[model samples]
Target chain A: MERVLFKPLSQVAICGGTHGNELCGVYMLKELPRDRSGTFSLTTVLANPRAVDTCQRFTEKDLNRCFTDTLLSDLLTEDSPYEVRRAQELNALLGPKGSEATMDLVCDLHSTTSNMAICIITHLNDRVGQHLFKYMREKIRSAPVRLILLTSPLSEGYSLDCLGKHSCTIEVGPQPHGVLRADVYNQMREAVDRMLEWIESFNSGTVFEGGEVEGYSMVEKKDYPRDPETQELTAVIHPQLQDNDFCLLKPGDPVFMTFSGETIHYEGDELYPFFVNEGAYYEKNTAFVLGQKQSLLVPSISVEKEQ
Target chain B: MERVLFKPLSQVAICGGTHGNELCGVYMLKELPRDRSGTFSLTTVLANPRAVDTCQRFTEKDLNRCFTDTLLSDLLTEDSPYEVRRAQELNALLGPKGSEATMDLVCDLHSTTSNMAICIITHLNDRVGQHLFKYMREKIRSAPVRLILLTSPLSEGYSLDCLGKHSCTIEVGPQPHGVLRADVYNQMREAVDRMLEWIESFNSGTVFEGGEVEGYSMVEKKDYPRDPETQELTAVIHPQLQDNDFCLLKPGDPVFMTFSGETIHYEGDELYPFFVNEGAYYEKNTAFVLGQKQSLLVPSISVEKEQ
Candidate 1:
């Protein structure tokens, strides 16, 4: 095999089972061949090792929520919770405060119980990220790819993806915690390989060329209807909307079904609902998030120019 | 609709999540219509309410293991672990120990990460249990049904199934904890409904006519190949055996493949493997269990004859 030599690039893959029950990402990172020859330097990490070992969501706090700026500095204590200290260690490894990131790009792998497609979560302002998303949408035909830009203010510095200059978190689902499906595993493995190949192509001066991406922009998270007194869930995902995630939810469409067999129609304007009935979000009472579809413009990206 | 009527029978279904992460049984029981008219009186109880709420396998000790005779004695105290106390409560509710079982039948629902199909686990001597298993095996065609006899000496009086005179726990899988698959859930629902219908027929003087049930009798558990020093898994299920669960593993068949691409052949006789790579059994270092095929004799079971 002829080696393709190109400009040096440093990329890292940060995978979390930090919620611990998510086994797809953990196993993917663990099973990845440690050493692979490529133009770009690649490093793989298990973001929450302890949680992965225990196969729980987290030991004390949700590790995904511990990456805020305040929690990063001066709050470090010897007796701090596992996730807080792990976040600080991750910061130093992937991103040191007030310093250039050691990694040029980060790929965080995640799995969910929602019927959402393979999602590429990146900031709206990231040009390179958008181009990569378009590439993956075309390159990985086994699974559909969607781009979701986090619009919440609190999401700014709270996730592992924010630790790098350019990052794309891959979310695949309709799977539960601690279970690995061969089909799902194969899809995820192919994704990691495709991602690495894309990075290699980028460093080797090959543009992703032309492609179109259809994605949803973050709008709002809608919680399930609950009773005021006991706060018990009063309704479930309506039969029409159940497993029909990412479909248009126009006004008058059945969105919820009350325990008493009454259907609640969507009262809002047309939008697409994703993350329908996600198991992890049950504690937060979230039924799903509604988003509006928009065509994403993919800008040409060059690795050497960025470097 | 003509309703079948006959001798009255009290049958209680004890669904365990008592460890809580197993949601199939919990949801099946919860979603089952509260009032169904039948000859057999039905009562359903969530074995481990607290564990079910937390979606964990268990809060303290394994709830299934805490049902031993010693733990059921007067030694249980307020300071005892959560499951120990929970076991005592269940005893009063289901068994009221050292007396006749409070219920005629129990159906403990369980899920596993293994590729095992719908399994009916019961003691070897239960004539009525075998009849029900044979009926389910023939009726529930969506998934194959297997009968597993808990031949272990310690298996007696240590599980919720022991709380009833005629009980067979339904084990369905290849699902993760806290997640529910529509297919798996539907299968379980149908099984529960079928079991109830079978019980009704038995009580109404209808004999489950004829069916030969090909079942695998428990032989032994086989663990994965692990590193002698660090005890890390050194190989994965071989390609030949992956998803080939419940098939006979003849001598010299491929069973595992080492990380270095070496094949480790199976040296055992023609025994069948089930529960391959079950997530819960990882703690026990169990890869799967080997069983020998045997024709289970279905005895004509009538409620009046048993009484």
Candidate 2:
């Protein structure tokens, strides 16, 4: 059996296949040579084995959603026939015992409900996080990717969020059933390569000067609770994203709005035009795409990554 | 043996003995009759039997953190073990199975690390959430409650934030060897009674027109990652709230600040003296809670909750 070998001094631990259906990262890892050749070793763990076998997002539970210290420990001990054991196995590998080697960076690859482009999910206040965010903007500014949603600290408690540091979830577009799409796979590959390059540069004494980090306007996750009586869509309007017309918006901005006209307004000083697609406004597929109507007219900022 | 009763019409579920050592809620539930027979019925579940038997917080996992959909399902499955079986049994009694029987309130009473007063945990959104926040403010107006740190929606995925609605974790402080102090217990009792009354008023078509609903300065969770190498506390300072005088910070002001000193100041248009605590300016805690320093004198503005 070929084993996944990582670089001894690798500071980052990038994992995909956390949710079995989100396999773009897994395929990318599979394509890489088994040995990293000491160029900052990369170890890839296919998180949920059973789920992967079934080509399902998860077997019993959303593994990404169950990363709290308590839940992780429980899965480690409990005896059951489920994918949690896979999660436990991966956790042990990632969080090795008595090893001072803590991951300085973690990128959990995922796919959203919409066919959006690449996005880097990081905490706003992290220097390294900001550095990576800036680097992505510089590298992939021309992609169909629109706005990078800054998840309010309150709404971030998942795998990357639970990691409690410069961990981010690089969201590719929505999953394509059991098979990986060519575009998404390529995009994931490119993103991983770029991230690895950035890590190498940082380790080799390259300076990552920070840039003007953009704050995300409130993008509320709309919940459509089925009506108990009718079992029909009750049209629950959760106005999570406050539309800021002053900030420059692009064509593919991820807008969270209710079918109703209730919209959240951006309070920042700048005003930008709003973008909209009339037909795909309400469906989950269209609603989750990242786009913007106005373009940020702010001065170009530079970010430096240091070793 | 007293049978555990399940009630759904009542929008309340009282679970005690989650932490075996701090079994105040357990004893309290036992002291009360099986059925309180109030407008809101109460269904009590003993979260961990093994933990309770061993007198510990948990046997293998912290029960409070194991409230995800998957874990709940695992607990409900027939072949599950002790805690999982108990969880299943409890779910049959209290899970969000029946549409009409969905629980609107869950009071997870817990003891904390300090000797502070009672702390109510609720999302900054939901009307009931606001009601609880206001109730706590009214209950301990002048008491040395230290600080009412609003757990960002990003902290606990099982919290009201993930519920995408409203829920609170009431931390009754000064746990004496994993047990609640007498005063803390009294405070919990009073707070629960008041909260119940508020809920009753809400159910009877009586709106809680207590006062103006305060706006929350939203903070992202990822921005506050603990440094991997230094292990030092870190957070993204929302650009809006940096370096500005915090004027007119009432018990319920939603102050939002970014690491870059940008301040998003919003309060009902009233010019009030903002207070600041310079000594308590540590990470995780509020920037204004350090010590008494020069407070901000700013013109207050009136803002309403975005419906």
- Over the stretch A1-307, how does candidate 2's per-residue lDDT look in tens digits? 2222112235566777776656566555555556665436665656676776654567777777665555556734456436556545555666531134445556777753243566676654444555565677678753543345344451244463334235656777533333343445556667777777776766665555533555343443332334479543322222222222224544344333222223333323222332211111223322222222322223322233332
Local distance difference test, per candidate?
A: 0.73, 0.46
TM-score of 2: 0.38
Q: Which residue segments of model 2 deviate by more than 4 Å?
A: A1-9, A75-83, A96-100, A145-156, A160-165, A215-219, A234-307, B1-307
Across B217-281, the per-residue lDDT of candidate 1 in tens digits comes to 78888988888997766666776786678888999998887654578999978999988877677
Model 1 chain B: lowest-lDDT 10 consecutive positions? B1-10
Clash pairs, candidate 1, are A17-A20, A19-A57, B17-B20, B18-B48, B19-B57
Predicted structure with the largest TM-score when compared to the true one: 1
- Model 2 per-residue lDDT at A223: 29
Q: Choose the strongest candidate by DockQ.
A: 1
Residue B201, candidate 1: C-alpha displacement in angstroms: 3.9
Model 2 complex DockQ against the native = 0.01
